[model samples]
Target: MLIITPQELQTDRLVNQLAKTWQEHGLDLETMLKTLREVRSEYTP
Candidate 1:
């Protein structure tokens, strides 16, 4: 008996696509927040 639903399968595929995109672009999610904070601080009045 199959237990996985169509929605679950689609969601998994979407997550994989994002991970692949990040790798192809050489972008790191970990540094995203820190980079944003630094930019904001540098420009903050």
Candidate 2:
């Protein structure tokens, strides 16, 4: 069995909005992923 909570739904909506905004600004998936990796590494140490 699986259940989706309200917070999860809201998070999904926010993620979709971010993706749309990124696309509107001409960001591609590869670039977004690379940026994410770089940011993660910066905070990981």
Say which candidate scores most in TM-score.
Answer: 2
- The residue-by-residue lDDT of candidate 1 on 1-45, one tens digit each, is 879754557879997888889778887777666899999999999
> Candidate 2 lDDT, tens digit per residue, 1-45?
999675557889898999999899999889989999999999997
User: Could you tell me how far off, in angstroms, the CA of residue 19 lies in candidate 1 after the best superposition?
Assistant: 0.3
Q: Residue 18 of candidate 2: its Cα lDDT? A: 90
Q: In the order shown, what is each candidate's alpha-carbon RMSD?
A: 4.1, 5.9
lDDT for model 2: 0.90
C-alpha lDDT score of every prediction, in listed order: 0.82, 0.90
CA shift of 22, model 1, Å: 0.5
Off by over 4 Å in 2: 1-8, 39-45
Q: Count of backbone clashes for each model? A: 0, 0
Per-residue lDDT, model 2, residue 2, is: 100
